[model samples]
Target: MSRLSDMLRTQRFDDYRFYHQSTINQTLHLISAIIFLGCYALLFTDAAIAGIVGWLAMLTRQTGHFFFEPNGYDAVNDVSNDYKEAVKVGYNQTRKIILLLVWGSAPVALYVYPTLFGLFDPPTDRFDFVRHVGTLWLAIGIGGGLARMLQLFATRDLTTGLVWAFKVLTDPFHNIALYWKSPLKLLRGELIDSSIADADWGADEVEEAPHLT
Candidate 1:
């Protein structure tokens, strides 16, 4: 348990220092985190509503990674993009691309097969179609998470896999706590985050840590 807690902190810290260089990206993550917290609250009362809102938060968070975050030589972390992606315990760029592709194609699949491979009923109207999409996306979201967790258990250790899953599930609350001041920093004209000085990423335990690149 103690080891899992430590691993979670290391993952979170690495994620923060590496991916969150842009104040804009951090700010967007902050917004997503808030929405996700609300989504979590609604999960007990209404799962469909939770799923839709959760997807929205997921979209916002991924938009920051896909668009706002930099993709170049990371002087801050002194590691190549390839190196970081290789050692990432969670979804790296390659995995993310595949996930995003599936997410993008989901609507088209629903449109062509209204029953959605027998998972959902045929939509009666456009609203129903959209609802079906949402329902499918919800399943995708949950499946993606579980798939990654299992993958980690295979490639890494069971503890690492479980910790990573815990980190992802609690990310909203954690991100909000970590990045609540990002907007204020942006308003103060800080575009990029300051460089970390000689921060050891525990490369012995975790293979690599990638910065905003």
Candidate 2:
């Protein structure tokens, strides 16, 4: 875990240094990709429209990560991202995009399903074009704002402390003591050795092994 720096505007790499690999995040990504693929298949004629939407999203995000928010991993003359600030910026941006995509999954799924099924039936006025527009805009705005906030954290912007403080207040359900203890402990290099989780039989803990593992 990287600690926040105490600076107004630290250099490119002074900011950003906290990390935790979450499988929930990976699952969300897989779901989003599968949803997009579903939409692509619904396009029928090779889904030229859905293809454009995906390509545009990809190009825009890649541009931000590679150029404007380049990771500081190699910037500090280190082997990889040694918990550097630039790398933090890149990661923060990635989170924002993920949030946007997560928000978008529902609407995109709706768009795809009805279309795929409707192919055999009469269409309903070519779909809810307005709702789709709203979803896209909402994803872009929310994602961009969140990404900026995370960038501020990396830069040691004065608002970093306030931002996290507000997050703790608004989303207290996330890091409760008993439930999320595993991930939090892992971050501190404390692995909670649970034989119940490791046991092959004789316990229901086997059902929830991944949560602790």
The estimated TM-scores of all candidates read 0.89, 0.30
Per-residue lDDT tens digits for candidate 2, residues 8-56, read: 1221112211222222322222333444454446457534355445444
lDDT of 1 by residue, 14-60 (tens): 77766778888999999999999988898788676777888899889
Alpha-carbon lDDT of model 2: 0.38
Model 2 stretches astray by more than 4 angstroms: 1-8, 11-61, 64-76, 85-97, 103-107, 112-131, 143-158, 161-213
Q: How close is candidate 2 to the true structure, as a TM-score?
A: 0.30
As for candidate 1, its clashing pairs are 71-213
- Report how far residue 189 has shifted in candidate 1, in Å: 1.5
Question: Could you give me the TM-score of model 1 versus the true structure?
Answer: 0.89
